[model samples]
Target chain A: MSEVNNKKLRTKDLIYAGAFGALYIVLMLILVMSSGMVPILYILAPITVGVFCGTVYELCVLKVRKFGPALIMGLLFALVACNGAWYCFVTATACALLAELIIFLGKYKSKFMYLLSFVVFNINMSCPYMIMTFNRDGFMTRARDYYGEEYANGLSKLMTPWIWYALVGFAIIGGILGALIASKLIKKHFTKAGIV
Target chain B: MDFDICVDDSGAILKLDPRTKLVMFLTSSVASLTCYSMENLLIYGIVLCVITILCGKKWLGVKSLLIFLFLIFFRYEIVTSGKGSAAIGGLLTSLITIFLFFFPVFMSLMLITQTTRINQFLAAFDAMHMPNIVVIPIAVMFRFIPTVAQEWDGIRKAMAFRGISLEPWAIIRSPLKTIEYILIPLLFSSISIMEELAAAALARGLDSGNNRTSYETVKFRAVDYLVTFMFIGLAAFFIIGRKGL
Candidate 1:
């Protein structure tokens, strides 16, 4: 019932992915239903989805399956999330992909992947928000256009300095924390948890 | 008969088909957005509240939406004080508009979903040029959230036994570290899960067209026609009303 390394995917493995995709869509509807209150919920959602589902698929498909399939699934999910205006979807997907690559690249046994994945994640965090606000008639343009000179005059009003940097820094660190937790847990219980 | 509010489980609108409820929702939103007159908006507001009561979803969800609109109006006031009375009026109008605008769109969404099964909803989209590639994957993704949440809870408890407090901020300060150490396994699990799902679907004999079964069946009842006509009638009144024509 076990193999050192297998490559051929069982039919059930594909169905598992499909099921997860449907699950993702339904969760998205739930998100829309509760958009305002649960902004941070979805930010952490992709990591869990990627880890559990991708790990299970890899297990069923190949005892020693690499991260390639999971990476592709992530890339697809990101593209769809982007089109769907689920702003953080792409960033989340990128984070997952980067982590997988790092782990596999580091030979799945290095603490270095942990650090590398974290570093890569910081640059990735700014991407989606930038893409979000940089479009025509978008928030950045709107803010600049409507606020005009007052925006540049250092706002004769109160503001949070370093808030933006804090957001990026914290979120990326949060993502790394998530990855670290997964790696540790999976290494310990990958077998008994049936995670392959 | 027209839709009526029922008070059983959670005090929601009952006896309305998904499609009909959806239409009403959209209509409400559009009407709210289209009308700027405070008087008109107030009238529409009453009508919406009544409908919400009728539909039985008199939850905080609807109430919160209105509150959100009010917040916007309040913010607008702070911003529009110098823009004149008309600006104030416009800002309020915009708030009202946004609140109501969701009505028609979400009503249809709620209607279809409420009256029909999930797969049926998927089928409707599928019939309407929704690519399987898109629909199928999205469905899977949607279902993954709860499962992951459950797993995370388990992991948190297990970690707690080893004296690890799963507080998000307490873990580390850098976002990069979190990504590397925590989330990669998530994406990895997602891809791995798919393999099992694909196999399961094959076992179940789900091909392109194998009579996708569903639980809910809906048709245009007499009352449905009546409701549709009522919408048209109201729309007509708006179009032909004073200042409209």
Candidate 2:
């Protein structure tokens, strides 16, 4: 176990990350695109993605048993899904780094640590909304002009600071649920098949 | 017999360097984030679409432009005009707004992925002296997206053969079963595919840890410089001149 922890990520590991990362991105894109249509679902987008993507994340981390996959996954997510928003990019990378640290502290063997890291990593879902929180007035005025008064008003009511907190809270809960589901699936199928 | 000189004719009218494409992608992404006004966003989108067309993706450029224009029209004319009920109009407005906001980024993404080849990306990243950690995964991803799409089609067919419906109504009715059915097979297939890809890559000496050479040589030409500066100028304008606009 220690030897595995100390080993550097090989080219194959990187390829595996790319493959799973692609799957993760595709799934997240479908989830986000489908849910992004409605306002309520858009608000819960992080949770939705977290719940669905946990299985991929868990598989990649467990298979590689290394540090780089999560970081690579974060970078891929930032590049693919963040829409070039610098804030989102920064937040996503930061969350991944924090997750990496947490997982490292656990030496990649602790299930509790992996779950905790995922919960932390899932906070990146709030990145797209960060601009809204920071530039509320600017975003609202633009929304008002483009989307009109009532739409802007409704958006403003939903863009409060407390809502951001609630979003983070919901993301953590979703991560927990997702990690639980992933663990069950891993035990049920992946372990038996010797894939993990 | 006269020996004829073979000219490399790839049909790309404007062959900008991959690095230039990277710059364009980043600039467009940053511009999408900073440029708030609809008119400005439209201009940015049009400029990118024109670039995409010049890169030999005429249909893609035209299609993206049409969709973007239609979204803008729908938002302003139909939804914002107060023709429908408040509930449905608001929903449509928000949806369209999100699409509009990210349209430029998506356009640039498509532009890069479709116009640039995997070898070009690898060669460009290699020239930029990026570590393998960053380069390999990205190259693999660019190569894998199409494969994933293909696999997804197969999975959909297999599900249908098994009498499993992936319709929205069916999925919503039993979400967990739907997830289990779709995700399990996809994961299993993808894992196998990755193993094969890794073996192939290793056999090609990807893990050789030497300064690898490539058949495609990436270099910056006049067009590359022009495109790079143009995008940089646009990004600067978006960031600094955003206030006046």
Candidate 3:
């Protein structure tokens, strides 16, 4: 336990994090950009990203077998996706910290714990939409003026508290499914190829 | 157009420090997000366009400005007029709004990535006394984004040859196959690339745990100070003027 706890991330681990982090981000950007144009898909972008990005992320965590990589990857995501939103940076860091804590609890060996951490990590996807909730009246008024009253009405309808709750629930389920797929892929491909 | 990360600073009209560019990116992004009026957005956008052009990315600056103008035109002349079908008009309006909302940050990102090299970033971070833990990964990530783009291009070509069209309709029809076809090869190739990169970096004494020097001398110049103050001022104005909308 001490040995596991004492291991620091070397240069190699950091590089691996960067490399895999890039891949994860690229995958996420592809998912989000493709889905973002449509309102419903935009709302569901987190689930799609969660489903696809787990493989790359799980691979990074397993390869690095340390705490810093998750936080680093989260920081990278926050930076890339911030788009001027400070809340994104805060949410991403907090979620990544939570993920790291979960992994630490498992001493970086429990596969289940890794998957559980990923579920929490997916919560950061809600960050981009947070402004809508935080400044609801301002957002709605702007939306109404810019996009017309109908569009604003639709958006406001979607912004109900229960909808956000449901979206979060769906995202968690997507994370679980994604983690399972990642574990299977790691076993089927990475382990056989000795990459893991 | 060539998308190389390293620009030839010799031809650059304005050579600002990486630190200055970073501050500009952060401040401009904050300003753009908090901004409430179209006039403020235009001012912020024009300032960024000028900075981008000065940084030697003339085509990108011009292209982004054109896109912004076009979006603004569409939003006002077409979308607001409500000439098209309501559903399609609404979708287009929302899409254009999102694009306008994020345009400044994307432009700043392009400015940073297109102008500054990885070594410059490392030197800047080092000067700031950032831990190696944070510095190495970011540097590597910066270097790797272009490589990933190149790899994705190659993969797309291969997929096309194999009759795996990445068109929206095709992707929507069979998402699983699309993922299996594209992701597997990409992951495999990326792993190999990561290994090579790690090996090369390690061979260069990346883990020596000593103070490292760089070939490029990184220091804040007069231009950097000017740019920093300008962006800080813009950000403050945006925040203070938030209620003006």
**Residues forming the 10-long window of minimal summed lDDT in candidate 2 chain A:** A1-10
Tens digits of per-residue lDDT, candidate 1, A77-190, equal 454334323445666577657756775677644555644554454333333333323332333332332233233122212113433444466455645554555456556656
Question: Rank by lDDT, descending?
Answer: 3, 2, 1
lDDT of 1 by residue, B1-245 (tens): 11221213234444444445445544554343234343454454455454554555565336644764575466446455656564444434433333343444444333333333335434545555554544554444433444455454555465678675546575446544443334445445554555555556566555545555544454557765766666555544543452346
Least lDDT summed over 10 consecutive residues: which range in candidate 3 chain B? B1-10
In candidate 1 the C-alpha lDDT for residue B23 amounts to: 54
Descending-DockQ candidate ranking: 2, 3, 1
Positional deviation of residue B163's Cα in model 3 after best superposition, in angstroms: 0.3
Model 1 root-mean-square deviation: 10.7
Best by TM-score: 3
Better of 2 and 3 by lDDT: 3
TM-score of chain B of each: 0.45, 0.85, 0.88
TM-score sort, best first: 3, 2, 1
What is candidate 3's lDDT per residue for A6-32, written digit by digit as tens?
Answer: 588888889999988888887887788
CAPRI grade of model 2: medium
The digit string of per-residue lDDT tens for model 3 on B129-189 reads 9998988887788678767777888899999898888898997898766776777788999
Q: What's the lDDT for residue B55 in model 3?
A: 86
Candidate closest to the true structure, highest lDDT: 3
